[model samples]
Structure formats: C-alpha cells, structure tokens
Target: MSSSSTSPGRDSKARAADAKPPMREALVAAAFQLFLERGYEQTTVDDIVALAGVGRRSFFRYFPSKEDVVFPDHERCLADMTAFLAAGTGDEEPVGRVCDAARLVLGLYAENPAFSVQRYRLTKKVPGLRAYELSVVWRYERALAEYLRARFASRRDGNLRADVIAAAVVAAHNNALRSWLRSDGQGDATAAMDHALGLVQSAFGTAPPPPADERPEDVVVVVSRRGAPLWRVVQEIESTLTRD
Candidate 1:
C-alpha cells in the first residue's frame, strides 16, 4: 500500500461522503431544516440552495416558492388522484369512489409519518402555510367534484350533488388525517380514514334506483264512505290503480 495507491481510495471515499441527495429531495430536506431552525419567514430560498449545494435554478425547478416546499408531495398526490378518478369505469358508486380517492391523500401522509407530523405542527404555527394548505385542499376537492359531476350528469341537481359530496369526502379525510397527526402518527391512520370516510359513504352512497322493470309494483289503498256502494268503491279503486 504505497501512499500514491492509497490516495485514490481515500479520494473515492471522500467523493461518496460528499455526494448530495437527489436535487428535489435535497431542496425539500434543506428547506425544512432551515424552516425548523430559523423561522420559515427568516429562511430564504438562497439559504436553502446554499445548504442543498444546488443553485437557485434547481430550487425553482422543483418548487415555485417557499410555501411549495412545505408541501412537496401535494402536486404529485393531486395528479395521482386525478388519474385514479379518470380511470374509473363510471360503474362504481360515486360517493364511495370519491371516499376512496380521498384515501390516497391519507396514504401520502402515512408514507412518512414523522415528516407528516412535523409539517402539521409547522403549518399550525404559520398562518400563511395554513392558508396555502387550505387552497391545496380546495384543489383536491375540486378534482373530486369534477369527477362526480361527470358521473352524475343525468341526475337532477347533479352539479350541486357533486360539490356537496366532494366537500364531505374532503372533510372526512382531513378530520382523520389531522387526528392522526395530532396523535403524533401513533394509531392506524388507514383505519381512522376508513371510519371517517365510511360516514361520508353512508350519508351519500345510496345505490342507484333499481331499473323501472325491477321496481316493485305500486300499491293503492281506496278510502270510501261505509254506506257507499261496493261497485262505486271498486270503480274508484280501478281508476286509481290503472296505468296511464
């Protein structure tokens, strides 16, 4: 092991140690680290890029602004939700389908519990981040409503129904997700989501009415004076029961 021979091996090890995380992940990690240490408002994009060992171009490529980094996965998650809803066959129950779609958001949070909990706490402290988060939530709700609108197009008040159901799904999902975050991600998030979404499903997921032929025949009851003639009563009943 001559000194020159050992030099190459040492250099290679140093390179490995110095290698940076993937650019996008690096940006997010650096941003959160700074956000926690120095308040989010105090930390700038330049500081994040400096820590990430990347340029401003790289940071902007991944995130439009500081707030976007706080919620890195939402764009990807929203795209996944859109694709999931678009792939539906239209045969599924709309309310139930929306509830399932809402679960995808829970899955995103559950994928990194510690990170989720950290972000949750951070958002609570920052009113701007909280407002940004609400806007992100509205986008998700809009996606669900759009999908439901197409599914329910023929029904009366279809648009209204779609919007209402979409709101319910979002409300149920957020309720469960925040509960899990508040608990420090301790319990079964999926089960809690299921229970919350189940309520939405139960409230709005009634099966479509049976086909006209499969529906049971309508029954009619005739009310007549006790002294009225039996024939008159029969005539009245027949008229009431007759199909147009």
Candidate 2:
C-alpha cells in the first residue's frame, strides 16, 4: 500500500517518490538493532518502525508481520538459489556447487553476524520463529529437489531419486552450517559440507552410470594386453592378427 494515490498519470516523480535501501532491508536492520539492545520480546514493531525512520504503514508494506523481520531477504535468497540450480547444479562437481550455495546462505548470516547471533538466540527461545525458520530451510530443499529432477529427467526414478538426493544435500548443508555458526564461523565449513554430501554418494552404492540408452549390452574387445610387457603388448596383438 502506498501512502500517495497520485494515480498512474501523476508522472514519473510520483514513482520515484515511492521508490524508497528497500524498506524491507531497512525494517530488518532496525528490528535486528532493537533486538540486540532491548532483547527480542522487549522490542516491539513500534520500536522497529521508529528506528527505521519509517511510518507504521511503510513497515507493514514491507513485512506482513513482525516475525518476518528475522528472515530478512529469505525470498530473495530462494530466488538466487533457484537461479543457481537452473544453471546446472549438476556439474561434474555437483557436490562442490551445492556446498558453494550453502556457503552463500551462511555468508548472508556472516554479513551481519551480531544480528544473526541475536536472531539465533531468539529463534531458539521462540517456538513460532523456530517453525518459520524450519519452513524456510525446507523451501531451499524443495528447490534443490526440483532442480535435480530437471537435471536427471531421463532417469527411471527421475524426480523421486532427485527428491532423496536433494534431501541428503540439504541435511548436510544445514548440519555443517549450524555447527560452523555455533563455533562462530570457525573451521573449514565448506569442507565439512562436502564431507557430509560425500555420504550421499557412498550411500547410493554405485558410481553414476551412463545416461539411459547410451550403453549397449554384451562386450566387444578392441585391444587386449593381459600380460606381455610394454611394447610387446602391441607386438602380440599384431602377431595374433597376422596369424588370423
């Protein structure tokens, strides 16, 4: 909802006026600051509004509810993640890319560690916030699943297999990230994420086979070198061919 109703024909200045950091970021920063100062429950939306230098109306325009402030750019993060997945999260080094995306989310917290820590504490104490956060995590997992489904569309299991793989990836990422955040972002978090994902590959029990229909049954021997040393191997093959 905009405070001004100048109408569409009001000219470009009106639009420019409406264009006001995004109000969302401002509210998040304001709320985060208040949470640090007065504590989570002690701080009110009014406090956030006052701190943001915006009216109550503007605050509501940006966030549907007060709890939304804790998430900040969660929607934007999902969009970025979707873009990453679409760009081939299925590289030869898929696990690497998945871990990189995990780092991106972690870095969002690192961008404002103090606020992240505060929010973390609040979320632990607040059931509602905790639930909301978990849902956000699931959104990421679901996106990964859809991406994998698209990447391996030709597989028999297709989306089902993708769902399982995505679940494993998401779990690994969250576990590693939470451990790192608890330790104040210490250690090789990326490596830890990779280690977790490695389990997925091992659990699958086989290397990824060639794409369906790309291989034919039975065998054809092009060249054999069971014994004969070095150059002798080629000589043996030539001799066999000549004798035939």
How many clashing residue pairs appear in each of the predictions shown?
0, 0
After superposing candidate 1, which stretches have Cα over 4 Å from the reference? 1-21, 207-244
**Cα displacement (Å) at residue 23, model 2:** 5.6
Candidate 1 vs. true structure, TM-score: 0.77
- Candidate 1, residues 48-122, lDDT tens digits: the string is 999999999878866788999999889778988998998888888888888889989999999999999999999
Name the Cα RMSD for model 1.
10.7
lDDT of 1 at 208: 66
True-structure lDDT of candidate 2: 0.71
Task: Give the per-residue lDDT digits (tens) of candidate 2, residues 1-244.
Answer: 2234567776553364246346667788788788778877788899999998899988776677888878866766777777776676265445445545665776677676666666777888778888899899999888877866776689899878778877887787778767766776667666776677677766642454677898666443446557757687777656766662
lDDT of each: 0.88, 0.71
